[model samples]
Target chain A: MTTTVIEESFRPGELEVRPDGTGNLLGSRCRSCGAHFFPTREACAGCLSQDLDAVKFSTEGVLYTYSVVRQSTPAFEVPYAIGYVDFPEGVRIMGQIAGLEFDEITIGMPMTLSLEPFGENEEGDPLTGYRFRPAEVTND
Target chain B: MTDVHVVGVGMTRFGKHPDKDATDLGAAALLEAVADAGIDPRIIESAYVGHVFQGMVTGQRILAQVGLAGLPLSNVENACSSGATAIREASLAIRAGENDVVVAVGTEHLTSKFSGALTPDPSDPEAAVGATMPGVYAMRATRYMEDHGMTREQLALIPVKNKANAARNPLAHFRKEITVADVLESRPIADPLNLHDCSPVTDGAAAVIVMSDRAAKKYANGRGVRLAASALRSGSVDVTPTSMTFEPLTWATAQDAYERAGIGPDEVDFAEVHDCFSIAEVLRVEGLGLFEQGSYPWAVERGEADINGRLPINPSGGLIGKGHPLGGTGVAQVVELVRQLRGEAGDRQIEGAKVGLAHCRGGKAVGIEGAACTVQILIR
Candidate 1:
């Protein structure tokens, strides 16, 4: 058997963008309380459970709500859309909306997550970022 | 526990002040409050100063300007609720016999901070990646719309009403009247949320003097309002999913204050709630048990929360119409309520106003709707 390893500088809990361009978020689940946490938690917030399991969350969800950013912030590109998505697992996550015109992102639109490069750090290192894109529409 | 009474309240005109430093504004408000109470500076036993980002020893620096040397000083940072928390701490200290007369002041000079970095760091996994305060609040507005079938026109009415009220308040930062169409057509910051829906970044300060009941009587002008209750609560690290719905900390804090004051939400004639965004005012009204779920907007639409409504809200024009100076907002809310209770709010006063409530919540850390919430009730 041959083991393959990819060499890359990544932050802890840094999400890997799948070859398909979908961004799957990795998180930790508390064994004692069945609580899910994003960006992973060392210990369970509920019941102080130390037993935790690593899990990959679905990269797709319905657009809960969103806002068009007419203003720019250092952490984000100007004229972007940001919103919360309601995952199938009943969890809500916040992320940037990518690959869409400012007027196109609407509430209740289906979206798929994608991991991309965030801006660099003070030291000029490329930082990986997570954002969501509109999913393909299907005929009912 | 001993009773605490409010002796004096002071506030700078809330607005953009590029010329003033936080310490300068804070010290000015303190001096005014102490003078209003006719208390000597040497008599203040302790002080609590609330500020968001004034670097190390911020509280000490502000008090030192007011001749407060070696007095017990604590800096509080609870986001928008910072001022309320400082006041609560000082009142508790007095009740516990730790001090006789204490001053609680809040100040913010945001013009000095970088406006481009207003959002929390998104590199951290728990950060609100794409959401600013307006974005989170827009979600609630959407939910409210879905649950009640409210229209955008109804939501726009909130800002219009608040701005109208603010026009009469000389101390309000934005005193210009705005119409529904003005709000509807304003630049959109978030979907369904226009720039008018949000409060502007402001620079100002507010202060209050709280003394033990005996001291208060000696200093008050025979009409000073009583500090009926003050309560502070922090978010729980663990809780059931429903706990997130109510934001447990705010609920608990309001409950504690209402119980201690022996008053329910219905008894409140008017309230100054955290309205950093228009939706926040709706949420706070519901969260504080003033109205049923999904009914806040209806209440607003029907003029139930207007200056002349059944239960006026933000009569001094809230953060949305006034200005949110971060640390100064919470204390300013209390000051507005005090003026109303004392029948001194002038044009923005609620007729026959007696019991008044003020709430402030802030801190946008991960997994928490708010890092802290403070509630206070006043009576004449």
Candidate 2:
């Protein structure tokens, strides 16, 4: 058997990618209070608590709202569905909506995290980024 | 403490001006305002200038061009509130007994900057995920529709009303009026928001001269409009997630202005708001307590937001029809308010208007309700 090493996430410290290709979004949870935040934080906005713990967020959420972005900066190609998903952790996350036709995505739809090839690093290596897909949409 | 008054106002024709730089535009508006006030340029004891994307000593450059250098000047950048914030700073100087006369100028050479969809600061995680300003407002529009049963056709009427008002404004960017079908069929920038519904990337500048009671009593000649209240506030950190459909930031800022001005929402005769998008006008008015929540769309459909309606909103065409120049936007709104109150807004003047309100909110940062919000109350 050939041993293989897994690549790191496109944005280290925000998204975690394990050797087995399993991953979760990284964030900060206030140790003093129970509030959570996305992409991590130094202090809690809710209570001004400096004590925060890095935690992984749930993979499932419900779409809060969405838009078919037909125009955007060059960093993103046009005509992509972008959305905000409210996770069970009481945090809303922004991400690219994937795994469905433009017309199929609707508000309050169930969503699941799906990692995909986002961009490359300085060394030109592939990086796995995250997107939200409908609950029934599956990827290998 | 002295009451503040707007002694003079001036603006450049709001449209693309590839030949002129921000400094040139600022200087032009400044000179026009000085002449309009019938005062010597040397009498302006201090200045505040607002601009974005115009690099390095923007205010200094404007002062240098207009022969008003060496005076105390502060360049303000509160994102879209930059221009409005400048006006507030100028008023504070008078109220604090620091200066008798001050000039606030807001200019932006946006066409010289980047085009396409404008995003928040690139470092923002929202921008990282491909957040366009139109997309954000479109999402709000979608949610507003879902929550209030607002139809697409009702939202389309906002642009229609604004562009029609813009058609009457010679200094506005869009002099031609548009229709509901035109707004609906225009090229889509984001879902449920088309190019027509969005404010154009415009280049323009505006200037206003604020004076203390002494200066105004000497120079106003009964023409000056009183700056009753100028309030500024930053978005608070949300302890709990707030509704995007309703803006507490706007309400809080407006409440501050109302309290300071000693006027209620019902007393306002007209308004000029930051309508960066059609949905934004709905949000801004409702947030300012001008209309009931989820009621602006239906009110607009009933021809209530028109220039000749019961309560005219954005009679100067707003950002949608008038054009938005980031820093120039807020100042231009004041110019409209003063004009309408003076009965000088030619074709789109709100008749017999005694009180006019202007609201500006700008920028987006994570974990905040809004970046910067300013509310101003002007009375004749």
How many angstroms is residue B88 displaced in model 1 relative to the true structure, after the best TM-score fit? 1.0
In angstroms, give how far residue B308 of model 1 lies from its true place.
1.6
Best by TM-score: 2
lDDT of 1 by residue, B246-358 (tens): 44676788999999999998898889888877878877888899888678778887899889899998888888888888999988998898888888889987999889999
Global Cα RMSD, each model: 3.5, 2.5
Please list, in the order the candidates appear, how each scores on TM-score for chain B only: 0.95, 0.99
Expressed as tens digits, the lDDT of each residue in B1-380 for candidate 2 is 79999999999999999999999999999998898889989999999999878887899999999898999999999989999999999999999999999999999999989697899998787887788999999998988999999998899998899899999999999999888899989999999999998999999999999999999999988989999999999997665556789999999999999999999999999999999999999999999999999999989988888888889999988999999999899999999998898889998878899999999999988767789999999998
Q: Which residue runs of candidate 1 sit more than 4 Å off their true CA positions?
A: A1-11, A14-23, A99-109, A121-125, B114-117, B121-128, B237-248
lDDT of model number 2: 0.91
Model 1 error, position A48 (Å): 2.8
In angstroms, how far off is B358's CA in candidate 1? 0.3
Go through the candidates in order and give each one's C-alpha lDDT: 0.79, 0.91
lDDT of 1 by residue, A12-90 (tens): 3646654444446777778888887665678877778889998778878888766666665555556677777777654
The CAPRI-style docking tier of model 2 reads medium
